[model samples]
Target: MDALPFALLLCGVFLFAGAVKGLLGLGLPTVAMGLLGLAMPPVQAAALLLVPSLVTNVWQLLAGPRFGALLARLWPMMLGIVAGTLTGSGIIAGAAARNASVALGIALALYGLVGLLKPQLRVPPSVEPWAGPLVGAVTGLVTGATGVFVIPAVPYLGSLDLDRNDLVQALGLSFTVSTLALAVGLALHGALPLAASGASLLAVLPALLGMWFGGWLRLRVRPETFRRGFFVGLLLLGGDLARRGLA
Candidate 1:
């Protein structure tokens, strides 16, 4: 693709992804990777996501009131995420890179299906200390492999019985740490190119703009219906990616 066209496509993708995040409180990186992986290689798509994901998630992380407490509690899990990302990134950037799309597709499909089903899983306080780092490690492995970071992390966090604001902030903190670790992994593996990084930085503007628009829409529109529809759409997109990968 030409430079101008690619940039335009990226802007559109991030804009839509950002809107989803603003409206639903998450999904920017997952949605972006699912779409971008259709054309770009998985490694490049992952690299492009690093900057915008980090910036937006950091903003989300700081916007909440319980940042210090959450950080203190989640530190072990966050460390595990960093460790797993660094460990798995080499495989993602190596000969196994071709399979990244398939992995991402599978991740998205599972996420959407789970969202649709809405299973209620509880994590009792007794188990949280051990579970946190284990879940974070698994999530980071998936993040490093496929550039999708939700999986077990989101569900695990949701099961913690946090209030709404704390839950959102916790998600943000997890994503920020995951994105930073992925960026470092990509850099270490030489998978990130200068041009792609630059484009990612520039794409942040459209993403923020779309978030503003989605936030406005959230105030005016009923989001439950929209969220369901979004997940359904993601399910289809993910299925298509998986099919293509298998083909």
Candidate 2:
């Protein structure tokens, strides 16, 4: 692709990804990675994800009122994510395109299927102590491998029985931590070059603009219906990724 065309495409991807996150409080990285993975290495896509994901997620996190309480409850999981990402980073940074594509495809597919199914999963108050770390660790490993951060993380958060705003805030907190951990991991592996970082910084403008637009839509549109459409898109995107990887 020509430089100009690629830049335009990258901005377009972020705008769409940002809109998704604004509407649903998640899916920014998932959408960005899925689309960008089609056109570049997953690691490169991930490097481009850092700034926008971190900035948006931090805004989402601070917009909530329950940060302290959520942090108290979710600290163990955050720590586990950091550790797991560091442990798994080298493997993913060195992985071939095919392996990364397969990993990304499977992760996106599973996330979409789970979102569509909307299982009535419940993580008992008692089970959370151990379950949180385990889930976070696995999620971190997956993020390290695929540059995507949904999976067990989103489902596990869904099971927590939080109110709507709290749930959204919790998702933000989790994603913020995941983005940071992934950045560190990529840096350690020398996968986050300066040029990609600069491009990622530039991508933030369209992302934020899209988020603003999506947030506006959220007040007027039915979120449940939009969520369904989003998941369906994910499923189709995931299947295509897997097919391309295997081919």
Candidate 3:
């Protein structure tokens, strides 16, 4: 693709992804990677996502009232994510494009399935101390390998049964840590080239704009309806990516 066209494409992708995050409090990396994987290598796609994901997620994290509490509770998990991502960085760096696509497809498909099903998995308060780090480690490994970060982590968060505001805030905290870990992993693997970083930085504007627009829409739209639609889209998109990879 031509430089200008690719830049435009990045803008469009991030805009949509950011809008999803704004409206739903999550989905920026999920949406961005799923779309970008169709057009580029997953490693490259991961590189492009680093800046916008980090910035937006930090914004989300600070916007919440329970940051200190969430941080205190989730510190072990965040630390585990860092460790697992660093350990697993080589997987994505060395993966064949087809394998990476298949992995990403599987991650997305599973996430969508879980979202659609709305399973009532629970994490008892007593078990969270151990379970939290375990989930975060596994999620980090998956993220390092596939350039997608939602999975056991998101589901685990859901199982906490936090109130709406707390849940959103927790998600922001998780995503923010995940984004930072992924960036370090990519850099360690030398997959985060200067050009990709530059493009990712440029994409921040459209992403923020789209987020602003989505936040506006949140006041008007029924979030549950949008959530269902988003899951359906993920299922279809993920299935197609898996198919293409296997072909």
Candidate 4:
């Protein structure tokens, strides 16, 4: 495929994904991964989304309240992220393209529903200790393969009810550390090439802008309403991708 078209498509997609991330704090990878996986290989898709995901969420962490407290509480969740990334690498390197696309598209569609429907979805002060390893492992497997693994954990994480500031802070830290681990794993497997890396990096500007736009739009709507829009959009996008894969 022509790199230009893929790159162009990514910029447009990230505009929406970043906007969603800026408002809700975690839609970048979910949306971008689903769209990219249609053309890019899974590991390559992970690599492509990793950089922008980190860059765009920085706004949230920097401005968030109680950032340190949230970080302190997230050590276990971070552990899960690491484990999930490592576990996911094996799957990414091996997953068939069509299968990976369908799985990621479906996962993205589901998580978008959670974000659209849940008025209260953020991290809590306390969560199940075992939740980290089990959930993280599954997320990591999906992350390595599809970059959509984070969706499974989003509902639980989103329901934290930490207000907007601490919520984004927690997610920034979470995605940053975990996506970094995923990048390492992909690099080790030689999946992080110059083309994907360049595209991913180039994507950061639009991603950040989109996040800012979404954040602005967020102020205009209720959380559940935003999530509903996000969910419907994902269902449409996910359905399209699934059908294409089937075809």
Best-to-worst lDDT order = 2, 1, 3, 4
lDDT of 4 at 231: 77
Residue-by-residue lDDT tens digits, candidate 4, 1-247: 6768876888897887788887776678877877676666656778888788777656556766677777676677777778777767766666476776676677776665665565554444455566655666666666766667566565556665656666667767767776787888787777778887888898898898898898798788886677677778887777777677677
User: Which runs of model 3 end up more than 4 angstroms from their true locations?
Assistant: none
Top candidate when judged by lDDT against the true structure: 2
- lDDT-superior candidate, 3 or 4: 3
lDDT of each: 0.89, 0.90, 0.89, 0.72
TM-score per candidate:
0.98, 0.97, 0.97, 0.84
**How would the candidate models be sorted by TM-score, starting from the highest?**
1, 2, 3, 4
What digit string (tens of lDDT, one per residue) describes model 1 on residues 160-243?
A: 999999999999999999999999999999998898899899989988987888899999999999989988988998888888
Question: Per-residue alpha-carbon lDDT of model 2 for 25-109, expressed as tens digits?
Answer: 8889999999998998788999999999999999999999999999999999888787877777775688686888888988899
> C-alpha displacement of 13 in model 2, angstroms?
0.4
Model 3 residue 65 CA deviation (Å) reads 2.1
lDDT, candidate 3, 1-247, per-residue tens = 8999998899999999999988988899999999999998889999999899999988888887989998898888888788888777777777577888898898999999999999999899999899999999998898888877788888998899898888888888888888888888888878889999999999899999989999999999998999999999999999988898999
- Pick by TM-score: 3 or 4, better one: 3
